[model samples]
Target: MWKVVVESKNQEQIRHLVFVDGINGRIRLHFDMVETSLRRKVYDNYNNPALGLPGYGPVRVEGGAATGVRDVDLAYEYMGDFYYFFKNNFNRDSYDGRGAELVATVRYCESYDDCPYDNDFWSSTKRQIVLGDGTVTDDCVGHELGHAVTDYTAGLCYFMQSGAINESYSDIWGEFIDLTNGKGNDSSSYRWYLFEDDKYGASRNMANPNIFEQPQRMTDYYYYCGIGDNGGVHINSGVGNKAAYLITDGGYFNGYSVRGLGLTKAAQIYYETLTHLLVSGSDYLDLYHALYQACMNLIGRFGITQNDCENVRYATLATEMNRTSTYCVYPKAPICDVGEPVDIFYDDVEGKEYWKLTPVTMLVLPKYLYSSEYARSGKYSLYGENLDVLSDFAISMKKGVSLPVGSALYFHFEHAYDFESEGSTMYDGGIVEYSIDGGRTWYDAGPMIINNGYDGVIYTGAGNPLSGRYAYTGTSFGFTSSRLNISSLAGRNVKFRFRIGNDEAYADDGWYIDNVRIYMCQVKIVDLTGYWVSVKQTCGRTSRCTIKGKFVVQNTGTSNSSAFKIRFYLSNDTIFSSDDLFLKEYSIKSLKSNTSKAISFNVKLTSGLNAAMRHVIAVVDADNVVNETNENNNLLPSVPFL
Candidate 1:
């Protein structure tokens, strides 16, 4: 019924064959030995050398059989794509910078019960990739390998903001490879979508993440903050994804306009960020700085211009990566009361405080010893024990306090400690630190301390964790007032903490703190006194008149006044009210105390009011953003048109 024929020059060089069927007629096959041998040689030399292990196969050829498997072929193809991309773009050898072989297992299942697993992941423990059956698209393969690259480079911690950044880097690389791979779809509508070629359609759109319930910007309402998915790593990654997309395809988003840099330039910026400018604990804010630094570094290389750097900045701004606070969390400082010194933050330690204690190590001893036994002005005080051996611990304010602008602030506290000490050498001690990034990192406050400075340095040879650092040690006899001038940290959200480190030997009665307060000594009140308003008019041939005036505003407060706004109104009387016809608004920069600024404005008379009877009134600080000492004096006397 069927007949088979083969024609060959040798065992290695098959030429042609014919399959004959009784009813279906003859089917001829032609094989090109040169092309097949060349493809096999190329795969053997390039792709096979990059793989750490043999791929799944049905033995179609010696090395070509592995490439015959669909999923295995996709994995090897994209891995080679990523390799060439980074090698040619950034001069990177491989994911590890050492030309290490990439390891991947396709059709990976956790167990026989869970066969045909539905996902792919980069095994952090194994340092390899495990591909599932249902999600092995090109971008997915590239995404998993991208994780390997991140592991070898930034090594960003997989939690919270850092975790989100990790996920976003993978997505960015995956999408980039997908767009430039010269296979599948690379159109505008499909380029920004991850997993577009998968059987289930696209899973995410980097240009507009809100289409898949992800936050395109940091302050979006859909930002996830839950504990699952490693603190919303997958959800919040959309912020960085949107940033990458905007950087590559320029758009207006979140009040910022970015000019698109092509894929190579954008990829260079991100590669520099991931490889050079980031750390394990870096967050979105750090990512912004890293991107900026990367752009600056690449200004002259590869034809990168200043405009590219500015577009990078605009992209970060559009994604709100410059925000220092947590995603979707807006912290507003309390408005300062008028006519009194503003207490920016106060904690008497009498039970209404939100202080959190964290131990630096795995010691079982209780470090925080908050008790009612010691107090400077209250019934309670925060205490930390010096009994823990070779221990470092800290108690920090859970919520950050925003320092208002235009004022000098002070950190005031009363504390006493009985630290272990030898003759002129301290073994146990405590120090004050402040964090500008919501307690993610802390810096020493010793440079800012003005009164009652650090007693001495902790002995370096005593095995104390905070050895060689200046701290409060020895007996203070009783509670002593400590003052620090923290005016440099104004206009920033900051958190404070007290850290104590002890050596392995002696124990003492510990440290006690009470009556902590951050206050401004002199209230920076902005008394906007409008001195005068001089008006003139220009009449056109159409009977329309343009009125122009120069209004002088004086800052009569004890301290400098910040930037404020001025509004012009046309009224029947000299008094300014809400019912008056608003004309125009002007912005005024900061003015020192006892200084004056003259601002000019022009308004065309459009309404049918009697020109001779109308009076122009000027009001300063119209938005009330500035705290003023004399709010009623902001209105200038109405002047008649000359």
Candidate 2:
């Protein structure tokens, strides 16, 4: 016998139907029309009173089996869990902090495709959550919502170390909410696993990430550096996940001991770091500092103690998050000496220094401008070749230089090029361009050339990308030096690049550039120092004191100074401030570099002034009428009057 059952429910009516087939012991079921409705409670942005009113109704359904209702129910339940967790703990209204509406679409499938979608993600552009079937577990819901919080706050870029941190944050919050939500499994055995209840088994182990092929420490061999998974965004997140786990539960791993601060304090510290301290480009080392700083900032509030901060440091060390050698370190500004002609930037092209090669056309395989033996001064020079017709290549400095103040700056390089040329018209050539606004817009720098200027303008036709622009075309016969007066870019940060283009008809040896340098002229400063040789005080008739002193001035700069005045003050401290009492103003003649002059001063102090309570301070170039490279060293240390 075969049995069939049908059940339906509504506010006004409830019905049940059962059929058993007696003939041939077979049963078949069919339905002409079936309808389902859902009435859900909707809450305001604030979610103030914790209870919502019934509002939304009638979910459309057509034809397909209703196998995804359970997933939808789980999504709603866990989303509510995420909302209450952040709201009660962090006082956050919503993901955006201003009560942005939380939108989620479950059982999502791409357009024009019928395959079962198996991934979940937060659409930053659409500002919503999308989940495939069977993926709406508690941690999964929390994980995607955490991304929204990150978007509105730190907005961490999703690449490299920053991207890894971004992924780890989602995992951290997801697991935290799952453990504390009071609805999911909170047992110790199940506490550290993400997606533990999902049908696909566990996705990651926060406490032991190595089991799932994730690097728990930075120095691990599994630490990914390849150009996959968005620079190993998912795989490298294991380091951060392990750090979070150690901070919360405490452990002796990787030779460092951490005392557990439990989930509350750990969450607070990580939340503060993510929302307040970290920027979009923050990496692992930056994260360590941010975590420690957040811990310190939370002291005296939220019951955070100094011991918790110590654990934070130990956890970061245990995870090797403070190491920079294992990953691509963020570029820092080159330090420059005061008056030296420092090469602010130089690329021999023997290996990658600062310039990055980019191909504008896909006409050739392995289209990279490489470092080759076509050297001018070094063993290797940046070389670009037109391997295929209609190809364009460029090599640009990835980092910018902050030109020194009060110095003449110049751009120097040696290059050789050979392009397809006919008479005075060049069909293929190279050009130089620069950008001051962080590579957003580039301007032709040919006008600033001071030596070995452009050879000719590229022909306006023949499918050359650099057509109609003055460039370095034709053969240089040998490597030649080029200089550009870039003093106008002083005090501003700038980046530069060289680009070469070829026509569809012909190609030749492209370009070779070496020994690139951005430098400045030797800076000169009129640095001055002063000292008091003698001070004699004598009392006058009306309780006034006559003070006499011998003062000396010395110029230590490389440049001679014009006539300048010196001012003496009576200060209680070594440093001079405006509140100090002015004693005398003395004039000095022009002093050559490295020369000294001594003068005697006689001045009667007023009756109210006490010479015994002050020290004598001398300041040269007091009005700042003369420019100096080191203006801070113009003040004398100070001498006692007695």
Candidate 3:
């Protein structure tokens, strides 16, 4: 017999209280919610007269006769428990047409109060995801539900490239479900339109993933999101999502036929690829392998051709596909990781320790054009407090040259602190402050202070600073606004200070900030069209000189409205070299469509000449190129020639 059960517990520990609801076929869910909340707590479910809303905080789903007709009386239930029962206990053969038995637990406690539904995944268990109340947008509910579905339908085996594909699947299907069920709009609704108003609206956009995206390649479905839940599953999924978009509808500039690949076809292809073809963390090359198989399977005995796998071919040519014969390199880096990494050190002053703070950056440019944006923006960022602080977050900011008086900007945020077991108060400076006066003075513009991550600050630099906040002091303040507006501030050489006064910028005993952002007051045109003019590999007088030429930049984009300033630079292999090597910069702005303009950049043979030849590579810009000032953990000592 199946039922909809809702039970009461101590509200401190995870407990199960199940009941049956056969009369209604509704699978009622309930659990004991802990007193601990991400930012706020569920005091009680007393009816309120203010808005006639039941409790002060979020509530449990009130069922028919199961709980009561009232909505207050919040209960504790979690996503893990429901997933757990569904996976282990709830089976199709066991069903009797009654309401399904889906048990769950409420939030226990976590290292960080991530976004609303942002679960830290202290560890992936069959029971709970262990979230700390981050900003789990309503979209997340279905996203998580999609995970449950993948867990069951796909046999829950963690497919790598397929994982991103699976994620896109969720976003696609979830958004589809939302629109189909009257929650949002369907094809009639623009993928750019917001369906759910005043709530965590919209899920995915099949039309354009680039809409509301931070960078050129990613989609609004996921990219540049704060890393609170399961190692950025949402953020990185755009890679596969774009594939889905292109598969459904032809690409914008990908120069491939994505028209014929609609939802029916996409779902068929992805389901096969995820469930049967790919493995977890199957690098780009691996994706080439897996998808090739998926395409074959999809065509079956009928037939297939090169045109069908054109996207797959393009992916191969674009891969940074470096594979070692043996999986053993010097100091082995983990197989699967997200984004470029930067170490964030935190020091302890008041006998408390700030664990870790990692920063991730997401910069958007025009599609297929890199150098043009790099030069047009004259983009340079200034960051301090790298000395030793727990404050490290990928700061995202939009640049705008025009603005009325009122414009909006938002920063996605989450507080990563529980502090009780660690005997800390989640660190002070619970606020983030923003400055429009180029860092001279800063005023709080984001949300008020709270312990959990649910309180994402939305501050407009409209006339004020902007949507920016970070922890200033634990008790007195919640979070300070670190986001800023860019209407009149755009290209004005603005300055920003993330952490406020009196607090250790990045101390061991402080809170960690992730997904920091600054947005434009209005949409601005961005063009990043540029390519390597031509690659030249020459051996200077020294053997090292040869390597230098192999690594130097030659040609870039041809000049056009979207121009690229070719600032070529070179660096010495001297982690311990006697002298220094600083690659210089130059400009070449000639960008035209459908062409790889020849950009010539020469290498300088420093006095320390040819002996110390390490390695060389020429990229469009400096983001991927590393040198002296830029501290990267992956840099290694020059391997002396055998």
Task: List the global CA lDDT of all models.
Answer: 0.75, 0.75, 0.34
The best candidate by TM-score is: 2
Stronger candidate by lDDT (1 vs 3): 1
C-alpha lDDT of residue 16 in model 3:
52
User: Please, what are the lDDT tens digits per residue for candidate 3 over residues 1-642?
Assistant: 364334346221344554446677554655543222111112121322232112233333323222331211112222322222223322221011122332222333322233233232212244222222332322333345456455444432232223444565556544433333333233465442322321344444444545545122432233443323332445445555555555545554443344335444444555566556543223334445666567767674223445556654443222212221122111112211222222111111121222122232222211220111001011211122222222223221222112224334323232232111113332323334445554455554434222222232312221111124333332211111132223343334433324322223233223333323333223222233232323344444544443222222222212222333333333344253323344444444533423444434456454545534343223343343322122332222323211
Q: Work out the TM-score per prediction.
A: 0.49, 0.51, 0.31
Q: How do the candidates rank by TM-score, highest first?
A: 2, 1, 3
Which sections of candidate 3 miss by over 4 Å?
Answer: 1-139, 150-169, 179-183, 192-207, 214-232, 300-642
lDDT of 1 by residue, 440-541 (tens): 889999999877778889999978988999999866543456788888999999999888899988887788787788987664556878766577777766
Query: Would you list the clashing residue pairs of candidate 2?
Result: none
Q: How far is 251's C-alpha from truth in model 2 (Å)?
A: 1.7
> What's the lDDT for candidate 1?
0.75
Predicted candidate 2 versus true structure: per-residue lDDT over 1-642, tens digit per residue: 455545454222233344446786544554423222221222121111221122122131222233346765676677777777787788676788666766666666654263356677888876767776577789998999999998787777676677888999999999999999887667889888999887677889999999889999988877887546856889989999999999999999999989988999999999999888876546787888889999999998778999899999999999998885354332222223345565777776667677777665443422556644345432467777754477676788888888887676778787766678877879888888889998877888999877777878889878787888889987654345677888899888999888778877777667778778898866656877767788777786677887788878888877888888899888888888899888789777788999899978787887677677467778888888777767887777455666
Task: Estimate the lDDT of model 3.
Answer: 0.34
